[model samples]
Target: MAVQWHYPLMSNYPLESDTNNIAAYLYFFKVLHSRKEKVPDILDINDITTFTFFKSKSITHNHMSKWGLSDGMTAQLRENVPKYVQQINKS
Candidate 1:
């Protein structure tokens, strides 16, 4: 028998970047699924980094409006994370 566990942390603020937490969790799931192993009782995910929302003030209003109007930005991040993770694994 095989079991997969998912523990999602819900915070008011974004973790690192928008969709970053989801991307990271998916990455871990992918790794474990490939190995077909049960999730350990104790796992460390404390290394994840978080970025502050306040920094958004530095971004241009145009970009902010675009993100609000469409799913393009979100879709891009979701698509990029796996490729980025695979690239990291090669090194």
Candidate 2:
């Protein structure tokens, strides 16, 4: 029989930017995989307090909307944007 362990990834402020957040997630995922550890598919940043630097959630939502980032887009960005940027940078 085989046992599997689960590890949760937490972030203070997710999607603060397109680049840094994705970079950090990629680095963390690489480190964990190299060590034969489990990495969660979803990043846990659902804490309302950590959602934004602003005091108001409404303000944060406004900013996110203006930037054209929905929750789905932000989640997908972490997985897809970094790789594209790396490829562009390498060329």
Candidate 3:
């Protein structure tokens, strides 16, 4: 049997700015934790990053009143995780 898992953490907070999207993922965590007794294993907080949200085209659409992003800002974490993960897998 195959099991399906979803990594969609942005569904809760629609039209949220890139930096403001953390709460949405928090909502996902809350839901997953609600049934903590059933699923003993769940992804850890350090497992993923939500930076992809900023790269998305809908960045400015974070506001219904704003159809597009006029000004763009970028964020970079001090530690490069994905890069290291990829290199580790190449072995």
Candidate 4:
């Protein structure tokens, strides 16, 4: 899925580290689940619990405006099982 990391209400912007970026991604999902809003059916309990940060890319302010970043975002979904640090390199 095309997860939009450049979301507003993001407590931190230009995420300083990979760890922080990953945390932000996970946090986004947490907020989505908490809101109990209309979410893609693909996001089942197991998917939500197992969702992992696959990748992210920077976006421009103009793009953010066009898409209504503050309102929330919808993107392609990538699913993966949680893995240990050592196994991360392999996957």
All models, RMSD in angstroms: 14.8, 12.9, 13.5, 13.3
Q: Rate the local accuracy (lDDT) of all candidates.
A: 0.35, 0.38, 0.31, 0.35
Q: Between candidates 1 and 3, which one is better according to lDDT? A: 1
- What 10-residue stretch in candidate 1 is worst by lDDT? 35-44
The TM-scores of all predictions, comma-separated, are 0.27, 0.22, 0.19, 0.22
Best by lDDT: 2
Q: Which is the winner by TM-score between candidate 2 and candidate 3?
A: 2
**Comparing 3 and 4 by lDDT, which wins?**
4
With candidate 4 superimposed using the best TM-score fit, by how many Å does residue 41's alpha carbon deviate from the native? Answer: 11
Which pairs clash in the backbone of model 1?
16-50
lDDT of model 4, residue 16: 42
Off by over 4 Å in 2: 1-68
Best by TM-score: 1
Candidate with more favorable, higher lDDT: 2 or 3: 2
Error of 4 at 47 (Å): 18
Order the candidates by lDDT, highest first — what do you get? 2, 1, 4, 3
For residue 63, give model 2's deviation from the true position in Å. Answer: 6.8
Model 2, 1-91: lDDT tens digits are 2212234343333433343343243443342242332222332333223212223435444454455445543444334545555654675
Deviation from native of the Cα of residue 17 in model 3, angstroms:
8.3
